[model samples]
Target: MSTRTSETTVTFGHPFRLAAIGDAQPAGTYRVVVDEEEILGLSFLAYRRTATTLETPAIAVRGGPHAFHRVDPADLEAALEADGKAPRSV
Candidate 1:
């Protein structure tokens, strides 16, 4: 199987905190990175960019005119582990 990764830019409309990422991310344009996989029957959402790293388990709140998709936090943690990175705190 081939692994798929996606990169995109997003603006944080609100403040959000992620474990191990250090500090709360403010509203701004961020570069997100995500690997494709089927987790808990949900799609993969890209991680938010932090000051010095990327935040995982992107809370995929797919809304509006786009297709709805969401990934479980547990699944995202697993994905991080599979990638040999520290899993986000539960």
Candidate 2:
């Protein structure tokens, strides 16, 4: 079994809340990490998401240890949609 990780940045125009991360997070750019595992016994190469996480304290914040919170992809999408800052292609 093989796994890979991808990281992307998303920005929120307004404060957003995620059930996984209690409390409202201030509006700012955040780093999101997604881990995927390669599917075995497949003729074609493919991967399935194993986990998703959001880095806390925003990227602009300093002087604090960043915490990674496991978050649902759907919830993150919804929050971004609500903030009108949908994830754009990198």
lDDT string for model 2 (56-85, tens) is 999999988889999999889889888987
Please give the CA lDDT of all the candidate structures: 0.44, 0.90
The numbered model that scores best in TM-score is: 2
How do the residues 37-73 of candidate 1 rate in per-residue lDDT, one tens digit apiece?
Answer: 4334337644432222243333453343322223344
- Colliding residue pairs in candidate 2: none
Q: Which segments of model 1 are wrong by more than 4 Å?
A: 37-90
List the candidates' TM-scores in order. 0.36, 0.93
The true-versus-predicted C-alpha distance at residue 27 of model 1, in Å, is: 1.6
Best by lDDT: 2
